[model samples]
Target: MKIAVFTWNLQVYNHKKAVLSKHVVEHIMRALFGHAATGMPFIGTLLEIKAPRRKDTRPYSEESIEKIVKALQDEFQSHEFKIIPRIKAIDCGGLPNTREWILVIYSGFSDVSIESLGFRKKIAHLIKAENLKAILKAGQRTYRPRQTYHTHGLADIMPNKNHFEKMDTFRIDLKKDPMKTAKEASRQSKLLHQGDAFDEDGDLPLLKQFRGETTGIYTSDGSDYSLNIEAIKKRGTKIANQDENWYRDGCLIKAKAVDSKGEYRISVVSIHLPGPNHTARDGNILNTFKVVGFRSNPDILIGDLNTHTEVIRELYRDLSTELSTGTTLKFNSAIDFGKTKYDRAILRTTSIWKHHSIAITAAEEISSRPGKIQPIRYERVSDHGMLTVVLHDGGS
Candidate 1:
């Protein structure tokens, strides 16, 4: 069995404490518990940590980074975990954010290397997630100009009837970027479909219905709805958790992975909203939480929420009680307060999953363990520190 865990602190800052956090390090170990339950052979695993770009004296002393990594190696003491440290790498883009911070915690299975088996594919997807900043930036350029929101009366429900009839066949040009196509659609003033759901707020926000069609990028008027369906479609489809209070026009997404043998597994969308302070009036942060609450099915949600980890705990508790699925994402927040490195994920199955204690480890501490540590450092990773967790289950 194999699993990869990661966390990033986008804007938050501190020196030694930032490099590693007890909250995050332990989380990675617990998250892996699930894989271990599968009884798979133990292979060497890589613990990759990256710090965000900062100018002043480095956020953390190299010694601090090294100490944390060493502590982890000593703590596990088991051959099962091959604790690595200080894995640094170059970045094509400068840094993550202006605040200058972000960290990565990647723990691979003990037996597999990047070159062997299906590890490459898994690592590739993770790398893509790591590079979401680029993807979002690209989306902004392609979607902003053409974006619009509309509401429709019952009569307008059939606006696209004429267009649909004229075209009996639907063809999506893979070569042409779909985002570009959606942008063009956004720019059109002419009504393509009647009862435009996006223009204004209705009983059901338009973005919610169209979430599956798009991926999860959106830009809408604060009151009504706005979602980037094109991006959602390409990345994965997700729906929001079904909480009545947050039953607005939003969505949650799930990821589907297919193996070479034609086998597949599904995962829920993991998301983190910017600080509520940054976008409070629109209630974007609260809306995001409510959406997660309302979404149904199996999922794992994670991100730098800009809210306290305690809030995440409360939401999970409410969701568990309301949905009757005793499940939650646990975090350890001892070092820093306020926003935590919100790294989390979910499995969409209907069964309750098991968990273990969680921790947060430093990047440099990992480096001191020379033979096993290989920290991949990058600049401007993000503001919030990286977050990760390990899970344990017998595999249902």
Candidate 2:
């Protein structure tokens, strides 16, 4: 059996007026699965999909997972498809908008089960736990008390009442008081553990809670656990100043497929990592593997990694999976930036699949004028090209 898995950053969030038109949705559906003339089953890992809100009306209404699925169903005319929409509410630098999502759309598979492992959330929890532990440890440290004048005799010895006022103005340092500091740290850690540290109104909202449309084991609760003060400041600074969100996450899909020889189980992961910060991206990749567990590797891992550094490359290499080559990004005339590949798919050599081939779409152009080829105006679809990895079962 040969399965086609594709990863694309749909860029719906970047759309003009942040609206994805019906025609654009249909174009995406056709461009991705329509070209599979070989009748091979397809699994599409689409990223940066903007979820529709009730406040959005008219032209903005069609930009949703439901609309995308409807377009796919209309294009394929088959009822054998399943969609796993992992809606993640992003914190856009304390901004009101939190609408981006990731989607895993599959077709022509009967025994397929997709799930959100919550590995990323678990990683956040672990990091928070460690941070709180450190704070608690710091709070337990003994500190020498600063010398202070006895207030009873200080006023009599003072040159004027102004000196007394100045002495009274000195604030008591929390570090000098271990008991108070410990109690405060304990209270904050408890609030964090109980998910009460965050302001109720400021919490990121999850779409699954209201829509009830997601079909997976895990629907994100939109709880952020990266509570380290410095980490929060770094992320906040980048989000506010650089206009980029550093929150990253992914999901797992398990399916059983049959070939000429026998049936085999396949594991696929759809991932999206932080884009602007390389350090965060690297840590995210490392924690992603930890979330996935180091014991077993997924058969296929696909998504936008924003891979521009060798650290990311080496991390994937250490995982025994090689990222598919070729430029996956399209030229941006708005930014005057040339093409570069950041989106990719990894097919594990240790997996059941024996052979593989990759194809990149939505990044090239055909000439309307005779013999006058031109670059694709990819802004119609996305900033990143669609990457499809075809894995063979090595059976005749």
Candidate 3:
């Protein structure tokens, strides 16, 4: 079987693209899931969701910008937009209210039931659940002109005949693995196909949400097997245990999956180790994750580890022994990583599959696409380019 391991850090586009948090999504979905003429094989995407900013600084003065940047950096925190009675544009006066700020969400998709024609859905129900009324009810009418929230009915996510609720999605959160206690996890693979019986509000809200760094695992819509984040652990104590209610990051998502071939293992980790102590913590996280994958006898390990200079060099050296160090193409970030450096991903070797024909999409290619341009933000959809690894699970 051919599978694509794709990892991208969508710095959480902060502009009109993130307004409805809709159109920007469609563009990305279309890229990987759009080709109907040719069916896409299994793909695992480690999407590091972009984050929401407290406010866009484009319209502010140099003095104010310096102060805000200093305050966030000094305190070691990223600000999220607060609930405003009426969210207004940051268009300082004569500035035509064009720019918008948004957040980076960590979400993934695979094994979608109704993705054959494409992954299109009306998401009005979703909007209400997330309580994004500020974005939907901004000013004269709706902040997002294209939002499919029917003018007459509930938001379209589960709108009518084509509703996600009816599709029987097999979702299981690793934090509460329903099958781990079983004698053998693989034996309980059938559980993934069961209907949506759990209370969405209670059981799986955090797992199945469009929030920050929430790793997702969607099994192939046609496959008989299913995958779940069977376990989760924090690598960096500080990064994982931050006090902020809105911020969530630094996690190792160890998954147990059963396919037609049988039970196997893999991992999706997002390590956000920042500040002066980043390099050491980053190493700790990577080393720990690799050891686990090896013990589990896995397929692949996909996700981000916010690595910088020394950490990047060390990661490649450490994984060289077991994992295939495929081609790594790093892209530049607007937030200067000491000038030229950018975010990158590197996949190590495992037992279940062989890596081949690996490639990274050109930054220019994705960056070139035209959209509602924001002077300082929109040019870069994501600071990091996507890394794709082709894996052959059969006779290599």
Candidate 4:
């Protein structure tokens, strides 16, 4: 089984706001959560102190908090899910005299390959409830407590919190900082390029001319699962899979690879659409899937598509009617403490669904906010967990 983990928006800061350091902290937290099956490691975190120290910003009344905790415990016990570790934090965001907390409850299959992992569905449903309750209660606080979860940002929960209040929005000086500007510009430029390439003359390069001294391009390309962006660009005329006008969170990454049936393909698009932007993004997804080249031949379209709505069924129906083949992206990161809904990762082919084993696997949300009153030592991470799946070689 093949799996991929996706995390977004990991912002770590210090009390002075000037001491913002997210790189080391983010990596540490990811390493901890990424390798949790081994053992609980004391992840290192920098401590900050101030004239006014971190205070408990939990908004829930004691009575209400107990009720919520009881509810979560009752649901967890009733569902038979094993309890994972939960961490709380006192101060985050580098805000002086401010207190915050984030609690992450990790649980997953001891062995990922077991078919019984589907039972995690029950746990996912319960965990989401717990998260939702926390979101609601935290929203009621005097100050909107920062979230340490994957997707449940203060914007997602409160929706009305001042966006300026987000501490990570510091205007990074790019002009005076030539290295930073060059790096970001180069990164964006690479992302704008839409093919694969190799350093040597063999394969293809995604971005043609901007090849030398570009450091992060390789990492970015590999992150999108491209072997060599330069190599793919050399293979064929890189064409936009869909309209250039439509700008969504995902991109159109295409390559030519042999199909399962042994036919060389013209174009393959790897997309990563945001989970929340369904209506417009779904239309783009359907349109791209229905394009002429993708419809007729051996091409693979795969990525994190945040759409798991009726739109998916509609796409299935349309593809079925056209005699084309497609499957909804499968991977569930839903835990019991929050709303449990699986984001999608779809792979489409000319063949029907029955011919292949498309296993959509669920992983636990590794990013979380420490609970209020607990000292925050780790980084503030994204709330959405990762979803990885494998399409076996023989599956149609």
Candidate 5:
């Protein structure tokens, strides 16, 4: 089976977002998945959906989600691509937090299955009830009781909370004076934690919390099966993933499917660590995967890791295996300021059916379908082209 995991940062700003989203879906479907006529492709997102803004600045509620999704479903159902969304948690942005960036898996290829892992009890509940695993978090950060696990979401149940062990990192500015930096860092941290202000430099804790947010996993809905999910709780700074560039979550999910065919275990990890300054953190994250058993097991790592060619070369410098990063860029990252390779991937110990490195030019075409009510011309959506890694295995 040829599978393509493409990453697109559709920074859509249309008020009629549903219409634009439909276009995005079709565009991506054609761009990454072998051909539009090919079987429905499975798409996973480490992306965000900006909500329709209002003066009140309220978080996205269930009603808003229902209407928006219904529209998308009505549009997608005809194409045989069902939107199986597991809403992990509503990311209430601070001040201008105008978007909800949950991880979502859009699969319509076949009888695909969905599962929720991590400390996302509310997300799990919704998954069970709606039969959709959400792109959500294990727990929400709160200051009321200052506890790890707490009640969140509209649901009554309290979500489970898991913490990342503080890791060792060489990226911290050892060049700076420690006494002065600590005093500054400590004061900034205290202010940010207290909500006294929203200075950018004082956001380390928030960044850490965001990077370690809860994420989910899924499989094709084939045959009756039972599932078991494991989360690698212990992490280190040296072999961990983080970035100061943007605020988002890191995902590492392990899933097993057992049915008549056989039993198969596959781990999927999505990363958003930026670089070249964060090289130590990025390397540590990869090494952490090795330490946590992802090295030996069949696994697929994807998302916007913000790596350049030299960095990629460095990452694979001493590798003893032929396992390759799935997508090769058609453009140079140095000139494009690394965005050319913003969304790169690495796959090892896994079976890949195909790999398509696609960079759609400034190409435009009119959609023939009346579904595109407007005389809509398709366009390249994001600045960074999609690097799709189609990786899977023959069942055990």
Candidate 6:
């Protein structure tokens, strides 16, 4: 038995503003799964799909889900598959109208069960735990006024004094000046407590806040001096927020397939990690593994990790087999930035399937010239190249 799995990141927000036409949808489906003539059973993990809604700025409605399902069904008229769509909304401050979602479509399976790990809730918990540590560290510090620089004009210069008067203007060295550092830390603690560091819902703020203060000193000879203090304040280290970045909550799907010989269980996790913050992305991936439990790793882990770094590779090296689908992202895309290999799939080494091969499909030629290839639909449909994996059961 062989099953083909496909993973793609549909750039819904940037591609057609989340409004996909039926033709475009059909084009994408055909490119990934091939025509019904092939008669291949497969599973697809689609990320960043914008659900249809009445308004552009409204959260996806139930009507939208129905419409998406209808679109899938219309495309795969001959295939019998289950469409599992999960809404991954942005709710950091308040619910925004972001309609990004993850859809897992699978067929040729006897039974399938999907589970929502509450990925966002896990992200919140991780952030809050780090914030508490930051607060504790801030509590031990004191607040000190920043250094001031004073300059006097000719009128203020005494007759006996030199024509020029200079005061120490160098920036305060927080490392050398423990007092000042402690003071700054105390101020940070206060700001964090005042809800300035975190959002209304207690989640870490996505944007940094600016704070400035000025203190004036009176000098004899009718002269005055002032110190202008400024600081870029944030409660703790910045983490990834689904609302602010091109991120959507991921889910785990499990299925049972029956063959002539017997039945086998298949587990797959579809995910899209935050791209801006590397530290946050790494932490989230590790946290996801924890949530999924290392004791029972999924058979297939597929999605856009937003990066292809050594750290990420090392994390999965021992647990799974990786497919090197070169440059799974489209060229000249906004997020491309010279970095490729964003989308990927990994199969557990202990899975029942023994062999696999990969194919890159949906290459849309932006230019009539040769070698000017882009992902099918590119900006119009998606910015990611479609990747398909065929898993073999190693039996006749």
Tens-place lDDT digits, model 6, residues 353-396: 65467755544433222223643342434566666777877673
- Can you give the TM-score per candidate against the true fold? 0.31, 0.56, 0.36, 0.27, 0.47, 0.59
Residue range 1-396, candidate 4, lDDT tens digits:
111222222122223222222332333334334433333212111111112221322343223334433443444343322223222122222121222111112222121111111112222222222222222222221222212111212212322333323211212333255345434443332232233212243222322223342211111212211123344344532222211212222223222223335532222223333234443433434444334214323223333334444223223321212211222212332332233232333344442321222222222334433546874443222233323222233333
> What tens-digit string does per-residue lDDT give for candidate 1 at 21-95?
443444444444433433221111222232333321243434444554555455454434445432322111111
Give the CA lDDT, 0 to 100, for residue 210 in model 5.
Answer: 17
For residues 36-76, write the lDDT of model 2, one tens digit per residue. Answer: 34456666766776645444332453444456555544544
Which ten-residue region of model 4 has the weakest summed lDDT?
111-120
How high a TM-score does candidate 3 get?
A: 0.36
Considering summed lDDT, which 10 consecutive residues are worst modelled in model 3? 114-123
lDDT value, candidate 2, whole model: 0.45
Per-residue error for 209 in candidate 6, Å, reads 7.5
Which parts of model 2 are misplaced by more than 4 Å? 13-36, 52-64, 78-99, 126-188, 191-248, 278-285, 293-296, 310-340, 363-378
TM-score ranking, high to low: 6, 2, 5, 3, 1, 4
Cα-based lDDT for every prediction: 0.31, 0.45, 0.31, 0.27, 0.36, 0.47
Q: Of the pair 1 and 6, which is ahead by TM-score? A: 6
Highest TM-score against the true fold, candidate: 6
Per-residue error for 240 in candidate 2, Å, reads 13
lDDT, candidate 5, 1-396, per-residue tens: 444555554444233445555655565555654353554335465344455544323444434545555665556565543433332322323233433443445443333333322222212222222211110111121221223212212112222222111101111322244344433333322211222222333322222231233322211111111112222232211211122112333455444434444444545555444343653433433333333323333355565555444223222221112223322222422112222344545555334222333342211232333334565533333444444555444531
Clashes of each: 105, 1, 24, 60, 23, 4
Cα lDDT for residue 337, model 4?
Answer: 20
Q: Which prediction has more favorable lDDT, 4 or 6?
A: 6
Order of quality (lDDT): 6, 2, 5, 1, 3, 4
